[model samples]
Target: MNRPAARLLTFQLPLAAFLVFLLFPFYWMLVTALKPNRDLYNLTVNPLWTWTPTLDHVRRLLWDTHFLPWMRNTLVISVGATALSLAASLLAAYAIGRLRFRGSGVLGITIFLTYLVPPVILFIPLSRIVSALGLWDRPAALVLTYPTFLVPFCVWLLLGYFRTLPRELEDCARVDGASRFQVMRYVTFPLALPGILSCLIFAFTLSWNEYLYALVFLSSTDQKTVPVGLATELVTGDVFQWGPLMAGALLGSVPVAVAYSFFVEHYVAALTGALKE
Candidate 1:
């Protein structure tokens, strides 16, 4: 083979291998979720295609656990946290990115830095605050705690995206006798929809998948989001229920995967972040 052809093969081989390696586990989980207990324990290799696929695990996941309630709780906390963070971060990022103020740079840095704060340090204190505020042992604890991370991360992410947009768009709106809020509502926002969507998806997924604070704060069975609730089930006994657990995990990840793919599909439709102003 020619040297260039050989180099191409070397690179392509590794890339293909890496992709297969990453995808194989997801394939296995789907396979496992579809397989009967007997086929699963039958001691087989290449279980993906070898097993007699069944929907029993999926059935049990929906019927056996409080799966719907957990999903609802997750949706509640995720949507609430995302909406709250989106509103607050939009205003804050706009101020920091488009408006001039003394100490704005320092405040922006501080907001970004808040994302790096470990939940371990803050959860305990926040739990106390939640108790004082009468939010303990409820899904509200998650809503409250999630903003600690979501607000900062969204603010930072949107700050960069907002900074890249042309100021002339808002300028034109003002010349048309639009108020600040009107410019944001009618012009600036239309231009920044992509960043807003991205932040919404990011913050929602983060809050949805959050386990630490939810596990620490929420005590009610009906109030626990899917992540913490599923984890609690994973440790009910010495032997883990790997089948149902994987089944639940499979279902749990679907929304997030759909959201990511949806965002990627329409990534170019918005005028922020990935857009070149």
Candidate 2:
């Protein structure tokens, strides 16, 4: 084979295998979501594909459970936490990347270090703080707690993006009598749109998919987010509601997929540019 053909042959097999491995779970979920329990368990039928598709699982998950409220709570907490994280990250990234302050390197490392700490370790102290603040069993608890990790990660991401920009732009804006905040608002932010969107997407995804914090912070049925809600409510002791569980899992992943699809180009470009710098 020619070199190009040999390279194509080399890449395609692994790519196809990787794609199948990654996508099989989603495919299984989709199939199971539409399959009746009879076909799902029947040894006679093909497990990979469903011959008879039904919306029963989807209908039951939607109407027979607290799915909508869980989705709403997840949305609210994710958006709130993303917004808060982005605001803080933008400021922190700018300061560390451009301000040239004393101990700024140490401070940035310290901030990023906080992100590395396991949530399992921090939740005990956080739970007490949440309870003391009267936020337990409420959506507000998640919105507040999510930022502890989100902001650090977002700041680290934005800091790399911020470092890639030309300092002269901010300097020129400053020379024009623009204050630091004014320069950030009028100059830096517009140029860093891709990075900002990337941070927003990351922070939102983290908040939306978080399970431990949601489980620990929220106790009420109405307050639980999608991940916690589906796992806890769909499984009754030893019995698992496989149909509705698969249905809920499929539905729960839709928002993050849509969000990623919308921002994927910008996110890719941001990472590329940051890496190039």
Candidate 3:
């Protein structure tokens, strides 16, 4: 017992240090967001607090700018992408997980590898296509293009989660007069819900935080997502409006952060080396 206790004591310090290092930037962002624009001119390495904290940055960003439209655009795009990705991934995962078909294994790999393809490789061509389709600079462009990235990853994730589920459960559902679709809807989906939902959150955040595609495919101020709008509108040439920028950063992160806070433990468990639960 003392040996295990001693090992834990030795490990705890380094682990705690690593956690502080990981979380420091977020803490810094929060601190900077609350600091008055006047004090931002001065250098402060301390993240704990400064001489004083204020809400003027957050207030002005909310009341004085077009941040509300940016936020709305982000919400609409991310939610639409999440829904489309989830629906598409469910069908694709079900096909690969439960059905036997020619070239299924090869197709699965192709789908996952598609996720690894960088946006940089496709953005130039995608922009041309969006322009050709009359979606360039349109919010509708995001409602379509974000899915290309979202579906592949979500399908891959859901496939793995569905694979881990007991085949017996699905088989039982089928024998109980359920069709293939019904089995997935009732048996597999419910059992795989945690990991599936985790991937859904990932897809939503990916679309929400995405910048390069939004910057390329959208140029209109009213159509910009938070990531692009905040960068373009808030910061003029060579001028960093630190206060409002920080405020926008904080607000942009809140939804994903809140979602992560709620589901992080579940996500950790699901992806952990342990598979039992």
After superposing candidate 2, which stretches have Cα over 4 Å from the reference?
Answer: 1-9, 269-277
Off by over 4 Å in 3: 1-13, 43-48, 270-277
- Per-candidate TM equals 0.90, 0.92, 0.88
Q: Considering lDDT, where higher is better, how would the candidates rank from best to worst? A: 2, 3, 1
lDDT of 3 at 238: 84
Question: lDDT: which candidate is best?
Answer: 2
| Per-residue lDDT over 87-205 for candidate 2, one digit per residue giving the tens place of the 0 to 100 score | 88888889898888999999998998898898999899999999999988988898888999999888888888888789999999999999989999999999988888898888888
TM-score, candidate number 1:
0.90
Clash pairs for candidate 3: none
TM-score for predicted model 3 compared with the true structure = 0.88
Clash count for each candidate, listed in order shown: 1, 0, 0
Candidate 3 local lDDT, 219-257, one digit each (tens): 878888888888899889888888789889889999888
Where does candidate 2 have its weakest 10-residue lDDT segment?
A: 268-277
Using TM-score as the measure, which candidate wins? 2
Candidate 1 on 1-277: residue-level lDDT in tens?
9988898799978898999999988888787778777767766555566436767778877888887899998998899888888889999998988887888989998988887888888877887898999988877777767888889888887887887789988998899999999998888778888778888878877887888888888887777888888889655887766678788889999988888788875443432443332
Candidate 1, poorest ten consecutive residues by summed lDDT: 268-277
Estimate the lDDT of model 1: 0.81
